[model samples]
Target: MHDAASALNPQALAEAAGAAMYARDTASQSLGMKLIEIRPGYARMTMPVRADMLNGHLTCHGGFIFALADSAFAFACNSHNLNTVGAGCTIDYLAPGRQDDLLTAEAVEQALAGKTGIYDVTVKNQDGRLIATFRGKSHRVSGEVAPVQR
Candidate 1:
């Protein structure tokens, strides 16, 4: 028997998977992160820098920025509806994020093979100034992110 979900296009499948993941992502939601866009092997998220997220130096904490990028990475890797997790990741901060700055992270898949994939994420401020670059390696686990549906 043919499954109805098998007829869904890649874009539809990705959107469904993203919605399912975002609904359960309490960390991202608590941090005011928004899933702006999602597609096969791509995702974009935004987070606003709040005063409470600032460091002693009066700038947004590096951890918060990293979290934004990581969330984007996660969404992008999982867009295929396959349960994927970050096997490793690295980030380089080029500039500090200030309070009230809206930061956007865009993650793009660089390569995918077998059960592994590489993703590159760029975090920028509202003014489009590059703040940081992140690279993540993803390993696909053994499950679907969401049940296939029509």
Candidate 2:
């Protein structure tokens, strides 16, 4: 069960099913985000900054970077097909990202306590240099699937 794919919880969620898939799917049209990988309690995704994503400083917006890691965080937290919600999160930007650069976000769960889980997300550039780091807390809601959008 520790196999890479198994560790990613692939059997529990198809590449096109569930909340992770949905978030990643919606990200394509909405956020222009692309999910790269998913393993048990882990997830990775990437995005190309658009002109609109730039901030007053003309680089990728800080909120956009946070969104990148947050998406991965949500995916990792819900890989078990359980409904979950973000209870809180904090992020630190170590560097800025540009519109022409490819940004990668990676999230890994740090701890789990029945219905509560903690995750750490890191964002890096194509060269693998750190751009940002995030810590997130999630609460597993009682349900067979992730929360539905009404």
Candidate 3:
């Protein structure tokens, strides 16, 4: 995996943060995280709902679900860095997810400006049921590009 810390500067921090923040486990990463697919201007991520990821209802917590979507958003927007951070996000819960279930969130770039971008994120259960939908706004801060950044 490309190490953002090693390769990216401010200009590419958005894309590099994913790999830079990657760890072996969720606890270690502090985010529901996995980079399953990376396409131009898009990303797909998978996060396993561990028991600790549940809420009072014994279902996967919205925070955890958001993490899955957020991580995918981070990856999709930051695929090449350019310094990205979510300015806002809206998520609609379509279905609750279960512990031990693996969920995937896919993010697609919807629009962009020199300083702002929008993305559509969808979280789905292992059976292909739509679990949640999210819209994210990101700010692409200006920064000098790193040489050959990931």
On lDDT, the leading prediction is 1
In angstroms, what RMSD does candidate 3 have relative to the true structure? 4.8
TM-score leader: 1
- The residue-by-residue lDDT of candidate 2 on 46-113, one tens digit each, is 88888989999998999999989898898788776677789999999999898778889988989989
**At residue 98, what lDDT does model 2 achieve?**
82
- Which 10 consecutive positions of candidate 1 have the poorest summed lDDT? 1-10
Off by over 4 Å in 3: 1-18, 21-32, 144-150
Query: Candidate 3 versus the native: TM-score?
Result: 0.79
Ordered list by TM-score, greatest first: 1, 2, 3
lDDT by candidate, in order shown: 0.95, 0.78, 0.77
lDDT of 3 by residue, 1-150 (tens): 346565544434434455553542355256546787765468888888899989999999998898889878877777654557789999999999999889999999999877888999999999999999999998887752223435
TM-score of each: 0.95, 0.82, 0.79
lDDT tens digits, residues 1-150, model 1?
Answer: 115755377887788889999999999999999999999999999999999999999999999999999999999999999999999999999999999999999999999999999999999999999999999999999988988855
Candidate 2 Cα errors over 4 Å, as ranges:
1-11, 14-20, 23-28, 146-150
What's the distance in Å from true for residue 71, model 2?
0.4
| Alpha-carbon shift of residue 104 in model 3 (angstroms) | 0.2
Which pairs of residues collide in model 1? none
Q: Name the lDDT of candidate 2.
A: 0.78
